[model samples]
Target: MGPPAPGDADDGTGQRTGAVIVVAGVALFATALLAGAALAPDVGAAGDDASGTLVGSHGGGAGLHERGSVYLLDGREIAWRAGDTDSYFDVTKLDNGSVMAGFMQSGYDECGPYESPCAHTGFRIIDPNPDSGADPEITHEYSFPVRSEKNSEVHDVELLDSGEFLVTDMDRERIFTVRGDEITWQWNASQRYDAPEDPTRTDWLHINDVDVIGEDRYLVSVRNAHQLVVVARGEGVVEVINEGDPESTRGDPTLLRQQHNPQWLGNDSVLVADSHNDRIVELERGADGEWTVAWEIYAAEGVNFNWPRDADRLANGNTLITDSLNKRVVEVNRSGETVWSYNTPEVPYEAERLPEGETVGGTSYADGGGDTTTIGEGRDVPVLSFLLVIVQTAVQTPFWFTEVHVAVTLVSLVAVLVGLGSIIRARVRARR
Candidate 1:
C-alpha cells in the first residue's frame, strides 16, 4: 500500500498538521488578547489626572526569589529605588528628603530571625537620592530579628513627632515605640487576646498597623481578629472597634475581614483597605458605639479590588489605593471613580503621595459622594488565584488581568493540547 500513499492516516496527515497550526494560532491569539487587556488604560483615568510624586513599599514574597523595593515615583516614572531586600511594607516621607520604611530582609545573626539580630525586620531611614544613580543609600536602620519572615516581620512604622518611631512587631504581637536603641513604650496584644506560650512560632494576633490618631491615642489594625482598636497610651485599649465579632458579643466579620492600612478619617470615621473582603471601606461609629460601613466600593473601573493592601483618604478628597494583587496604585474620587492610577512594579504593600502624604483626610463617602454601587460581592476563584500567584512571582501583571481572562487563556491552552494529540495520532497511523 506504500504506507497508505504516505498522505493518509486516521484523518489526513495534512489535515492534522493544519489543525495543529490552527490550535497553536488560537493559543497565541488568546495569550496576546489577555496581555492587551492588561496593558490597556484603566477606565475613567483620562481627564481625571493627578500631580505630585509617590513613595511605595512593596511586600515581596518569601525568600530572595521575589524581593521587594522601596521606591519613589516622580510623577509617572520611578525616580529612585532601594531595598532589594526580602520585603518592605510601609514607607513614609521624612522631613529631610529621606524616607522611613518598615522592612524585612534575610541573613542576620543573634536573635530569632533578624532580634529587633534575630537581623531581618526593622525600620530604615533611607536617602532617596544617590548622586551616582545607584541604589539609594540606607543612612540609618533600626533592625529587629524574628523567628521567620512570614507573618513575623515588622509591617508598619510611623515617625512620631517625639523622634521615636511607632513600630508594629507582628512577631511579638505588640505595638511599641523605638527610639535610638531603646523601646520607649510598648503595648502587647497578649493583654487583650488569649496569650500563647510562644508567639514567635504562631501567626497570632497579627497587629499589622498603628497610627497616632490623636495625642496619646492610636488606631491599630488587628488583621486576623478583623477589627481596629483605639489604644490610649498607658490607659490600655480605651475603645475596641469590632471587638468580639462573634454572634455572642459583636463578632461582625462583615464589618472587616483581615483589613490593612486604615486611615483615621475622623473621631467617628475611618477608611480601611478591607483586604480579604476585596473592597475599600469607610466605617462610621454611631452614638451607640457600633461601627457601620458608611460607604464602600467593591470594584473600580471594571476590575474588582484583589487583596488591596492600603487605601488612603487624600486631602483633595480622592482615595489612593495600593491594590496589591492587581499590581497597581489607583486614585478614585470620593464616589469611587478612578481618577488616576499607576501600575506598580510588583505586588506593592503601601503607597503615599508626596507633600500632603496621608497625614490628613479629604472627602468622606460616609456623608455624601455618589457612585457607591457595589460590584458583584466577589468570591475566591481558587484555581485562577493559585495560577496568578505563580505568574506574579515572575512578572508584574496588568491591572485588568482578572479571572475571566484566566479562564479564557486556560481554555485556549486545552484546545492547543488536543490539537497536538491529533497531530501525534495522525503521524503514528501513517507510519503503521
Candidate 2:
C-alpha cells in the first residue's frame, strides 16, 4: 500500500518507520513479551440486547495482544500491560500520576458481541510503574445495580479535585458519585428528567459520559435524548444548561442531537464529543439556557477523523481525540491540522495526552469467559473485556516537532540517504 498521509501515520513525516521496526525488534530480543498473557477465551456469538464487545484475534497464547506502551516526545519510552482486559475504554491521568480507566466486565446471560445485552461493568486504575513486580490495580469494582442482568456498563469516569469520582452507568440511566468508598450523591433519570407518569411509557435515556465542571455543575450526555445537559450536584439535579430545546409539549426538556463528554475548556465554553454525527462541537452559553456552537471538527469528506469518542482540549490550543472504531489517536491543532497520530493493534475508547507529551489510552475486546481449552494466568477469572489503557510517549516524540524541528530531522535523514545512494552509484560507474 502507498504510504499513509502525515495525519494518518504515527510519525506523520514517515521518517521513523525503520526506527520503529528496529526498536520493536530490540525490545523483543531483550524481553520475551507475552502475547495475550491474560485474555478471555473465545465465547460463541454474544446474546441480544447486551453491551457490545470489541473482539480481536486470539494469537500467540492469550488469543489477543495484551501489550501496551507509552512514549515521551523526546524518544524516551515505557511499556506495560493493562493486566488482562476484555476492552479498555476511557483513560485519564490523575493528579497522582496514576491512570483511571473505564471498561466492561464480560460474561452475562443477556447479549453477545455487538449486542446491547446486559453485561457487568467495572473501572481500573493502572500505575505505569507499580511497586516493581506487583500487578496493576483495578480500583473500585462496580456493577450498575438495578434493572435485570443485562447491558449495564460504565462508559466513563469523571475525577474531581476533591478525590471523588462521577461514573456514567449507561443502561441504568443514571450518574452517581463515590467519595471515600461511600455513595455520596446520585441522579436517576426517571426522577431527574421529565418522565411520563407511567414509567413503562417513558423512553430509555442512554446516558453515556459525565463531566464535572464545578463544585455544583455537571455536563451529561443522553444519547437517545440527543442532547448534552448541564445539571447541579445536590439532593436533586437542577438544570443549569441545555444545548437544545427538546420537542416536548410539556416544555420540560431540551432537544439535542447525539453529544457526549462535555468538558469545560474555560468558564464559559466547553468541548463535546459529538459522536453520532462524527464531530467535535464547542458550545458556549449565551443568553438564558441557549448555547451557540462556537467551533467544530467535522468528520466528513477529506477530514482525518472518524467516530471520535472523547477529546481533550489541550493547554496548547490543540485537541487530542480518540478516533474510536478506527483504533487511533489524533492530535489536531487549532487550525485543524493533524500534527501527530498513533495507530493501535486493537479497538480504542479513550485517550489522554499528558503534559510531558505522552499519551495514555484504552482498548477493549469481545469473546470473554475462558473455557477448559483456554489456559493462561488471569484467565477464567473474568478477563474484564480486554480494555487496555495505553501510554504512548517515546514513539510520538518525532511528531511533536515545530516546523523547524521537523525540517532539521527531515533534511538530516534525507541528506544521509542521498549521500549513501550517490556513493553506491559512483562505485557502480567506476566498475563499469
Candidate 3:
C-alpha cells in the first residue's frame, strides 16, 4: 500500500528483492552457456566421413531395398571395404588386392584452366594398407577431361593387362585408351553415327561399356542407340549386333533398351544386361549371321531384379547381377537360383568377384601397419564457426559486465540507499 519504504525496518523486503534478482541472473547465465554448447558445430572424424560398416536390412528379407554400407562378400562375410560407400559405377579388386572404383559427383570441377572442364568424374585406386589405421588410402586418382559442354563422366574404367587404362567417355561418345597421360588409341562414335548439331547437347549414344574382346576388337554398348556394336581398334564399327528401334522387339527375345555392360562370352556369344527390360540375356551368333538368345533370366517372386545394370558370367557358369534400383548384388546359378547376395547403400552400378587368394589383409603393404598421420578434417559449414564465435562473445560480455562494472555499480547503489535510509530514519525519530 505504498507504505513499505526503502528503510522499511518493519518488513526487510528490500533484502529479499535483491536475493531474487541475483538468483534470476545466475539462472539466465547458466542457460546461455548450455544453449551455446548445444548449438556448437559438429566436427566428425577425418578421411572420408562417407564410409562405414554394412548393416543388414530388417528381418533379413530378400529384395527389400534398404540402405547400408558397400562391402565385398566372401561366403556371406565381409572380406574388405574402403570403410566408406559411394555412388560408384564399377568396383574391381585387382590381383594385388588394390581396389579401383569409378564414381561421379555433381557440381564438382577438378580441372585446370587449359584442361577440359571435368564434372567431378574420376576413378581412384584405394590401398587398404598404408602403415596407418584401418581407413583405406587413395594411391592413384584420374579425373576425366570435359573438352565440350557435355559432361565428361565415365561409366567404366578397366586396367588392361597391357598396362593401359581403357575408359568409356559417355559425353564424347568415344572409347579411348590412356597410356601414361596420353590418348594412345581413340574410337569416336560420331565416326560411325551421325554427329549432333551441338556435340555438347547430345548424350546421343551413351556408350556405357567398352570391353577389349580380342586383337584390335572392342565390344561396346550404345544404350541410346539400342545396339551392341563391335568396333575394331584401327577400323570403324565392324559389326552391329542389335541395331534397331529400341521400342520394337526383335529375335526370339525382345531387343535391349538402355542396356549396359556387354561382356563377350567365348565362341561369338555375348552376355548383356538388358536394363530397361529387367532381364539378363545371353546372345549367340548363329552360322546364318543372326543373333539369337541362347539363355535368359528374368525377375521372379523372391529373386526379383529392378533395373539390373551389369551381368558378368563367372567361371563356374553362374551370373553375377547388379540389381541397381533394388540395391542388391546377386549371383545366380544356371538354374537361376540365388546362390549368393550382398546389399548396398546406393544403387550398385557394377560388382565383380576378385580373383582367388585376394583378401582384406592380402595386400603387400599390410605389413606396414596402419598410418598414424592425421589430416585436418574439413568443416562442412565454415560460417557456423564464425556465428558460434559471435554467440560466445555475447555470452561472455554479460559475465564481464557483471564482474567489472555492474557488480560495483550495484554495491555502490545499495550502500547509498542504505545510508540515505539511515539518515531518513534518524530524521523521523528525531521529529517524533
Candidate 4:
C-alpha cells in the first residue's frame, strides 16, 4: 500500500510497541492486586495482646487436611498440639488438665458395615501437656464408623457429671449420649424434620452443635434447616426457634443462614455464628414468643467476616468469634470493636478462653454494634472467581483481596489486551 503505516516495521517498531502494551497491562493488573490488598483492613496488631491459654479446634476440608489438630495457645505462643486424626472440632478443656476433642479420621479397620479403610468419627480424650511442646497422649476415644469423611463427623461432645458424654452426630442426624460403650440416650431429628431413607448416604440434616443449656434440656443447632430446637429429656420437641414447616427446607433462612455453634444465653436469648450470612447475631426472644436480632456485627478490623463458623458470648461481655475463611479468632466488644485476636495458619472451627470456661447465661448486648453490613459482600467478577478457585487449589489466598478488587483489575487488564491486539493486527495488515 502507500508507504507502510507508522509502526509497520520501523526497525522492529511494531514488536517494541506490542511488548510495551502487554507489559503495561500486566503491571497494571499486578498493581491492582497489591493496592486492593493494602486497602483491605488487616488484623489488630498480633495475637499476643490477650492473656491466658486459648484452645482452638482445627478442621479440615478446604485445604491440606489430615494435618488437623487441637492446638492450645498460651498467651502469644502455641504451647501444644494434638492431631492424631484427619480433623478435629469442638474442644473442651476439662478441670483435670485434659482436653476432650471430637475428631474425624479416615482409613479405619472398624468400618461397621462399610468396607475397610472407611471413616471413623467420635471424641478423644487428650492429655494436653502444653509444657512438653509435643503431641500429647490420646488417653481414650469413643468412635464409630461411616462410609466417607464428607459430613459424617461427630461435631460436638460434652461431658456430664454423671459419667455420660453428649454428642451431636451428623452421620445419623441425632443428639445422643454415650456412657462407656452404650448409647445411653438419643433424640433423632427425624421426629421433627423430613427424614431420608438412608442418613449415611446423604448429608440430609447437618446437625452441627448441641449444648446442655439447662438441667435436662438441650439446645440443638440444625444447620441446613436454619433453625434451633430445644429438646427436654422426656419431651420430644418442646420448642422450635424460627419455626417452619417440617416438610420444606424450613423457616426464614434470612434470619440464620446455615449457622454453626449457638450459645444459649438464657431462656429468652441466644448468640449464633451466622455463617453463610457472614455475621454474628444475638437474638432475643420477644414477649410474643418470637426471636429477633438484638445485636449483630458484620465486620471487624475493616475486613468483613467470611464464613464465620463459631461465636461465644464471654462472661466479661465480649464475643469470641471464629472467622473461618479469614483464618483467625477474634474477640469483640458489644460495639463490635476487636479487643483481642489470634491468627491461625489454617482454618479453625472454634475457640474457648480458659479460666471462666464455657459458662452458661452470658450477658446481653447492652448497645447495638458498628458496621451494619459486611465489606466485599459478594463476588464481583466471573474471570477472577474462576481464577481464584484454581489458585486456591494450590495455595490459600488472603481473605481481604475481595471480589470488588478482582473485578477492577480484570476489567482493566482486558481493556489493555484488546488495545494491544488491535495495534498488532494493524501492523500485520500494513506489512502486506
> Which candidate has the top score in lDDT?
4
**TM-scores across all candidates?**
0.80, 0.56, 0.60, 0.83
Candidate 2 achieves a global lDDT of 0.49
Work out candidate 4's RMSD over C-alphas. 4.9
Query: What is the Å distance of residue 71 in model 3 from its true position?
Result: 3.8
Task: Sort by TM-score, best first.
Answer: 4, 1, 3, 2
Candidate 4 per-residue lDDT over residues 364-432, each given as its tens digit? 772333213322343324566556544432355677656665566677678577658856775676666
Best by TM-score: 4
Tens digits of per-residue lDDT, candidate 1, 222-328, equal 89889888888998888887776444323467778889999988877889999878888988777777777777877777678888889888877788888887777
Better of 3 and 4 by lDDT: 4
* Model 1 regions more than 4 Å off: 1-49, 59-65, 111-119, 130-135, 244-251, 360-362, 368-397, 405-432
Of 2 and 3, the candidate ranking higher by TM-score: 3
User: What TM-score does candidate 2 reach?
Assistant: 0.56
lDDT, candidate 3, 284-326, per-residue tens: 6667776666666775225334457888777556667776655
Clashing pairs in 3: 51-83, 51-84, 131-369, 131-370, 131-371, 132-370, 132-371, 133-370, 133-371
Q: State how far residue 421 of model 2 sits from its true place (Å).
A: 58
Model 3 stretches astray by more than 4 angstroms: 1-70, 83-86, 106-118, 130-133, 145-152, 245-253, 300-303, 356-432
Worst 10 residues of 2 by lDDT: 371-380
